[model samples]
Target: MSSQKASRKAKKKQGGKQRAQRATSNVFSMFDQSQIQEFKEAFTMIDANRDGFVDLDDLKDTYASLGTDPEETILQAFKVLDPDNKGVLHKDYLADMMQTQADRFSRDEVLQMFNISPIDAAGNLDYKSLCYIVTHGQEEEQA
Candidate 1:
């Protein structure tokens, strides 16, 4: 009876391993060879101790090697973006930002202008409104 139980456990373990392999293969098959290699290299960088797994220690070591504290970096960047130091970006401030060299309308401005019109039942702009906006409607003259 013990021998039979051991055989059954072995079969179950083998079946689980096979299922895991199949799942891994299906996921990897979505990417080409170059993409797979790139992902492997990225994973290797994140798995700093080379133990084939990423933990908090590995992440700390990786970030330490790069000499960057992500939280401080993000906070500094936000400070630069938020000149008034309001801790949040207002719509007008976003609209005035020089995102591109061209004179095209800012996305925030477009959305604000679109708010004047009635939205559809789904809270989406209809095809006609989309066309009017894309075609540079009377908003251009007003600007």
Candidate 2:
């Protein structure tokens, strides 16, 4: 084959792979209302002060409820997502964490799957909204 033809073929192959990956990732994705409710409940439980934010202490408490006693893991997880490190988790931070955890989907894809509305009409997400998207979701459906 000519060089031009070979280059075109390679590009087409790469594009095909990208499309296939997206399709595969989206095949089992969905979000339900109950999942949203569950996330809200979990967030409420973690936000002991009802300040609409969850601090490290609140996170520790939440993990304890989940039977996970990884102080280091929890701390690391928090550090990874807590850009401001205010020790309090905002909704958008939580959503980013959730997207990281999902692994199969990109952050944007995960947001879309959860039906999260944009923040301030700028097409971004806030802490609370991100929290809801990350926390809400059925395990079986995720599988």
Candidate 3:
């Protein structure tokens, strides 16, 4: 009976690992060169001043363009997402923030830009997860 129990536990562990691998694979499949280009373009558009960074004003403009109101709460969320404390957001930072906020997300929620996901059991995001989200919406029409 003990041996059977051990086998079951091992199988469960293997299954968990497999799930993680699948999630990672799915995430990586989403990130292609074109996706990177799209992100760059989007970032450029957000940074209207061409200042190489997205400040609060730029974020507000982006929100407005999306037909969303940039309320104080939203602004605070942006600030929380901006890790560099440069008062501006980089493309990578935005991507990370978006992915981290997605559904089943284990990471801390910042802006309401993402839906939390449990795809990755780890609290932090792996590269593939980040790549997947950054490329998500843009892929369908571009391809």
Candidate 4:
């Protein structure tokens, strides 16, 4: 029984190493040589402790640098993306994160901007004001 447990532990560690190795890709296929360096730079920024993988601790470290905690959604997203829970978050999910997280962030910004719009500067969200902001704002911007 003890040997079986040790075997399982060894297999898990080996699987982790295999996953790490399988993660490598031809950077040129996704980005040009110059862009590859930019990614490495960004990865280094996120990879606190100078480790190759950005784990949950790195996120906390990054937040410490910014003097804030990671938002609930961001924490959840990170947990979901890092399925192995090996405390090492593989970088491939970073690309997917950019797409998913970025969209939600931008949508939030739009909602905030709309909320503050002078379309209802009087602080009342009437139908007329909504229409004016929806149509008039674009016309004014184009002018």
Which candidate should be chosen as best, given TM-score against the real structure?
A: 3
Q: Which TM-score value belongs to model 4?
A: 0.31
Per-model TM-score versus the true fold: 0.33, 0.28, 0.34, 0.31
CA shift at 87, candidate 4, in angstroms? 29
lDDT tens string, model 4, 1-143? 99999999999999999988778755468778888899889899989889788987887788778877455434455456556554333233443354477454454554554453443334332323333444334334563
For residues 1-143, what per-residue lDDT tens digits would candidate 1 score against the true structure? 99999999999999999999887787777899999999999999999889999986787677678997644554565467666664544434434553443565667665765565435554443333333443334364463
> Which residue pairs collide in model 2, if any?
90-127, 91-127, 91-128, 92-126, 92-127
Model 1 is weakest, by summed lDDT over 10 consecutive residues, at 127-136
User: What would the per-residue lDDT of candidate 3 be over residues 54-88, giving only the tens digit for each residue?
Assistant: 98678768877888764544455656665554444
The weakest ten consecutive residues by lDDT in model 2 span: 130-139
Candidate 3's TM-score reads: 0.34
Ranking by TM-score: 3, 1, 4, 2
Instruction: Give every collision pair in model 4.
Output: none
- Per-candidate Cα lDDT values, in order, are 0.63, 0.63, 0.59, 0.58
Rank by lDDT, highest first.
Answer: 1, 2, 3, 4
Candidate 3: list runs displaced more than 4 Å. Answer: 19-28, 50-53, 63-143
